[model samples]
Target: MKTKKHTILKKSVLIIVTFLILLSLLGQTDLGNFSSQDNSEFNYVTIQKNTIRYLQKGQGKDILLIHGSPGSIEDWNKIIDSLSVDYRVTAFDRLGHGYSSDYEYSHHIEDNAILTNQIIKQFNLKSPLIVGHSYGGSTAAFMAVNDNNSDQKYIILDSPLYEIKMQPIYMTTTLPVLGKGFSLLFSYTISDMFIENGLNDILVSIDTNQRNTIIKQRQHIWSQPKVIFNKSMETKNYNSDLKQISNRYPNLKSHFTIVTTKDTLKTFRKDCEKFHKEIPNSSLIYLENTGHYIQIERPWAVLNIIRQKMEGQPSSYKKQ
Candidate 1:
């Protein structure tokens, strides 16, 4: 009876493993043909063997906008028009996000930062003010630390500056071969539904119509299996990158304007405060009632801050 039970257990395990391998194989079949209908005017530039989609408008001192994870250049649509009116505003689809070409390397924040610097150089942007939101904030921070231009100004919006614990899904996708398999599986199975549900929470200040539009756009890029794996890698590398930045915070030379909403995660708010206190030339702003997507919810606030930075306004803490 014992031998029979052992044989049955071995068969069960083999069947389960076979089923998972088959599911992962199904997940590997690329189903995403992601497209952005609003990108008719967008242009592409190849760097490091990866093609990046970008948009530039208006003319003045340059302003580079770095968007969040699982986001595209369209994430800045609400403020792009206003900012582009006076400033040479530039935004792009980061590698593995939006329509940009995917790479097998880990999408670390530092890599994005290096890419951002390359964009600055490639586009001939002259000491432009950098505005980064969410994951983009980390990229901006890394750029500011590495670049020698002390006069460069940065506006960070609701970014994770400290080493906060990642979600279980993000953790699960960091495994070796299992990570890729899990990312593929998740992308094929529930990534769209997850993104749809998540939009409601992040885009709280937007109306139903606007929120629906964003949800559709996000669903397009995030449904790609490569994009899913890219995000997982970024999240996995976030903590180590921040740890490196933390050591160099005191020596940071660029002026920083950190903005956060009243309804931000407690961990984010705490980190924001800690980041503000540590950096010598950093200023913090708090906006009431706005959720995570402050740029979408309060474009004017971001615009006003950009204008202030352009005008050489002194950094000071304020509430909006």
Candidate 2:
């Protein structure tokens, strides 16, 4: 009787495992049609081996937008229309994200900065104002410090500028074969759900329409295994990159306008404050009742800040 009971228990466990495997496979099937067919309106440029996808509109001083981890050019959709009205707005899918060609995750911030510079040179953008969000902020800072172009100014939107505690989940993706397998499984099985939940948490003040568009764009990119791996590498290596930036912080020449939110994560806000203190010339602005997705929540406010900066206004913000 005991043997029979053990056999039954084993069978029950096998059945449960089989059911879960089937569920994961079914989820992949449901999301298999991941394509950027909706973004055909954008143009592409081949920078080296990577085919960088971008959208350019209006005509004025170049306003380059760089998105964060697991993001694409579409992240600027909410504010692009408004900003394009006054400036020549350009946004691109960073290599290994969106429709761009896949590349190995080098975990060095300078790699992205170099690619950004290449894009600027290829398009012959004359001292464009680069606006970088989240991880893109690091890229912008690198560009300012290294490119040494006197005309370049920057707006960092809710970026992680100081040291950060790496999450174990992110570290897992930096492993060898295990990382590739795990990234593939996550991307195929639950990337959309992860993207949706993350967006909901970060974009607390966004409207339904804007939220939906952001989610769609992020989901399309997050579903790709290469993009997922790249994000993992970025998170895992962020602390090292921050250390390098800290060493070169004083050398940053481009003027900066840093934007943050009242509702930002405690650690992230602390980093922002540290960044502000280190860079005395940089201006820091706080938006009340906002989260990490400040660009989407308060596009008009961002536009005003940009306009003020362009008009040569003095830097002002309450010191924390």
Candidate 3:
């Protein structure tokens, strides 16, 4: 009788697992073809089992453009045309964000940094310039400091989460029973709040219609069980390791971090200011009246700043 009961429990677990998988597939279906609507103003390539939609254009020095959270390659589309003229700029949606494939876990900066390094190697591209915005900025900084041989200069524009670091609330929740419950909550409800509320908070300036469109897409990315599971696991901050990196930077001196047109209340802009001050020979561009999304808001200005960083060209950008 005991053996029969054990067999029943095993069968029940299998059935539950099968249901969960079907639900995941169902969620994907709900997202529909979130791709076709986007005309490939920029081209794309695949990695792993997923597609990495990106715009690769121009020549000269290779530049890898990284977008912020919950954004796709299109986020850089507004500036791609100008950036591509001088440098070979390649910008893509990070894993699990847009059209890119999801990671085993929704890996954060370190995972994305490693992924970028791999892509750089796979394409046989040079160490190239690394330009990142928002979370992408953080990832680019990680790669720049960590990459021993990448011939890369770093451009950080209005990075929202710089190092005003705080431990993620989820880490505390993930402790023993609390953690497992948090895992469940994050995998389900908490992700919804992040999508619904968090997007609104950041893109507060977006008009009603445009904001609604993003919110719809945001909701879709969050609802996926796999994505929620992956992101929830990424609640830790590895910025402390960055201090060691900064100390090694002058030797790793091929990088430049340009903090353009400072956004005072906009998340981590001040941290960029702090970092800019700390690093020797690094200059900060505190452009007046500039917001967090400076690259999209002002492409020529951003490109000019980048040019100065990469080529040591004369810059029209003045000190803040």
Candidate 4:
């Protein structure tokens, strides 16, 4: 009886492994050409052995825009044009996102900060105001805290500063042997549906053109198995990374302009409040009814806040 049970367990394990292998193979078929955006319009430069793509326009004060996880430089599409008119706006695709080249090893928020600082140095940007959203916000904060330069200014938008509870998909994709297969399979099946739902959930309104552009940008996230896999690793590591960086927050020299939506998740709102209190010279602004993607929902308000910050005036706005 014991021998029979052992044989059955072995067969079940083999069957599962075989299924996973097959699933991975099937999922690989869909890995066709994927471009997050029209790379032709952007400028490319090599930094730290990685080819980075960035967009720079307007000519005044320097402003660096950092996007969130699974996002690209296109995340700033609505606000970049307006911002570039007044400031030299620079936006880029972080490693493994959009058209940026991916590396074999996992890159964290610290790496992002390092890469962005290099961009500032390489481009000769002097004392640029860094604006970051979500994960990008964390990256911006990381850059600000570690830098000795007191001139660096940062605006953090609804970013997670504490540990995050991993989502089911994230958990599945981080698993050992089967993770790659599962993520690949997920990409081929329900990935786009999830992306669409998430976009709808975040944005107040989405026209045909806006929807199409966003969908294309998001598609790059799941277009390759490794990309999705790296994303999952990022989600898994984010909380621990944030914890490590928390001690340095109090030492940050830059004034943080934290903008959060009233309708954002309770956890994120709480974090934003806590972060504002913890940091020395920080101001918190609450926008009503706007979802997580506040810039897209209310770009004008963001612009007003930037202007106010630059002019050293208090920016208070009524919810629209």
Candidate 5:
């Protein structure tokens, strides 16, 4: 049995190595060739000791884009150019997502926000505009409400699960049965395919060939032992202090929300609505013909809406 297992491991490693070689040979590792009508480009930024991947593009007023669970920075690739035209745009892979190494302490959003705040401060980004999607949206909200006297505008994009309901992924990450491997082969492949299909469904703009290339690259890169180990250790303890943060939303600076007409919005709609109602300056826009991934689904529309808000227009946020 031991010898057989050893042989299987060797084969797995060999396959991963071959896949990497092919990706390099075919130049399939890039974020994809977005249109050149946009002059700006995304450049990866590394924060030491994080083992994470981030992209910061353009040079102007800052806008940080945060992606959801199990997603990478490419989630915002569709809108980076549009948003970056006026605001410096930054996007990053959350821990356990994509090239970002799942660290021992990054399973939840508190540490993620702290690290991100540090990144902002380190880079000296003046008065950043934060845009968070799903889980990333929650982090940006918490960060905004808690960062007293900070100059950050928050754009929450379809964030659902919060500390109040505590998304069940927390428990699953800690499960003993499935904890041996961060994911079983069946679940792994299923989740991978789910993401690929989700992107196609929501982001109808990306070309099929480039999308396939990115999906294949993701599969090959995650075929490693380190990711599994990190996932195992990342299951315990998250933001126990989100209530206090949520309570202080009225004090946050420049809050905007995208309430996409997607099923995921049902999870925390009551909470988000209550927060928006109480927060004096917060605006929530309902995208009429889009889903949870509205930023990707209608990048141009979101960009225009954000620009209108930034330009201090008398905007109508609700759908007619």
Candidate 6:
């Protein structure tokens, strides 16, 4: 009877080991073929212990672009050319994303803000305009609050400035041991599913070339465990970060131009309105029938608003 029990236990262990090995092999094949064709074009800047990857184009007043969660500098690919024509456009892959070194275990918004300020200082950017999208918007706001003495303007595009409810997958990835295991086993697979499912229904309106670029960028980042882990941490602690930002909201010195659409998450729209009400020297623009990816969906609207604000035009999008 003892021999029989031992035999059953050994068989079970063998089956589990076999399953893990197969899963690892599957993950390798499916996640390892990311194309590195566009990597050569990026420039690197060493910030503290990590190297940041960035792209710079054109020459004029500086405009820094910060991308959202699970994103890289390529998020601005569609509008960079046009924006760079009039401004020294610089877009960077935030830590752990794209070509940036994934040395950090946590990617809290405030840390990202500090990194951004470092970039601005390193480049000696003078009175630069910072444009942040989604999660990037949160970082921009935090940077503005902390670096009040810096002459900076901000344009927040469909950002979750106030609060965000964590998604199930993000929550699952925040677990200690289980999180790493899940990321290793399923991050690329989940990313593939998102791509197959049209990537949140926002990519349908984007141009094919731009959409492909964004997908390639996502593929590269999703395959990296550090990036995935950091993203999960961001989601897990997002609310606390917002609360910290809220305390400093009254002291922010930068002017802001907020562009948002009603079709986005309800919490995001509410937060944008709250931000406009609480933060001084800020204006909000509401776009009808648009998606959250306003940068790609309606680049002209964003550029026009930014140009008008920078050129001292009257703020036209004030809430009644």
Error (Å) of candidate 3 at residue 72 is 2.2
Candidate 3 lDDT, 1-320, residue by residue in tens: 99999999999999988765555445444233234235647456666666666667888878888876546666675677777788887877777666566636335577788778777876777867788887787777677667654445778877643343444664644353344334344545566676766666555344688667757766765555434433444434434534535565555454466665544655466667766765554566766554566665566677778777768665457442
lDDT of 2 at 281: 61
lDDT of 5 by residue, 240-309 (tens): 5455466676676555654554343333455566667766667766655555666765677667666665
Candidate 4: RMSD to truth: 3.4
Question: Model 3: which residue pairs collide?
Answer: 106-230, 173-179, 174-179, 261-287
Estimate TM-scores for all models.
Answer: 0.89, 0.83, 0.69, 0.86, 0.68, 0.84
Alpha carbon lDDT of residue 245, candidate 5? 68
Which pairs of residues have clashing backbones in candidate 6? none
The superposed Cα distance between candidate 6 and the true structure at residue 285, in angstroms, equals 0.3
By lDDT: ranked, best first: 1, 4, 2, 6, 3, 5
Give the whole-model CA lDDT for all candidates, comma-separated: 0.81, 0.75, 0.62, 0.78, 0.59, 0.74
Candidate 6: Cα lDDT at 74: 69
lDDT of 6 by residue, 219-242 (tens): 756666555666778889889988
Best by lDDT: 1
What ranges in model 5 sit over 4 Å off?
1-48, 161-172, 176-189, 193-244, 250-254, 262-268, 314-320
Task: Name the regions of candidate 4 deviating beyond 4 angstroms.
Answer: 1-15, 19-39, 205-217, 220-223, 318-320
The segments of candidate 2 whose C-alpha lies over 4 angstroms from its true place after superposition are 1-38, 148-151, 208-213, 315-320
- Better candidate by lDDT, 1 or 4: 1
- As for TM-score, the candidate ahead, 1 or 6, is 1
Q: Model 1 misses residue 13 by how many Å?
A: 3.5
Model 3 C-alpha RMSD vs. true structure (Å) is 6.5
Candidate 3 lDDT (Cα, 0 to 1):
0.62
The alpha-carbon deviation from the true structure for residue 232 of candidate 6, after best TM-score superposition, in angstroms, is 1.3
Clashing pairs in 5: none
Which numbered prediction scores highest in TM-score against the true structure?
1
Higher-lDDT candidate among 3 and 5? 3
TM for candidate 1 is: 0.89
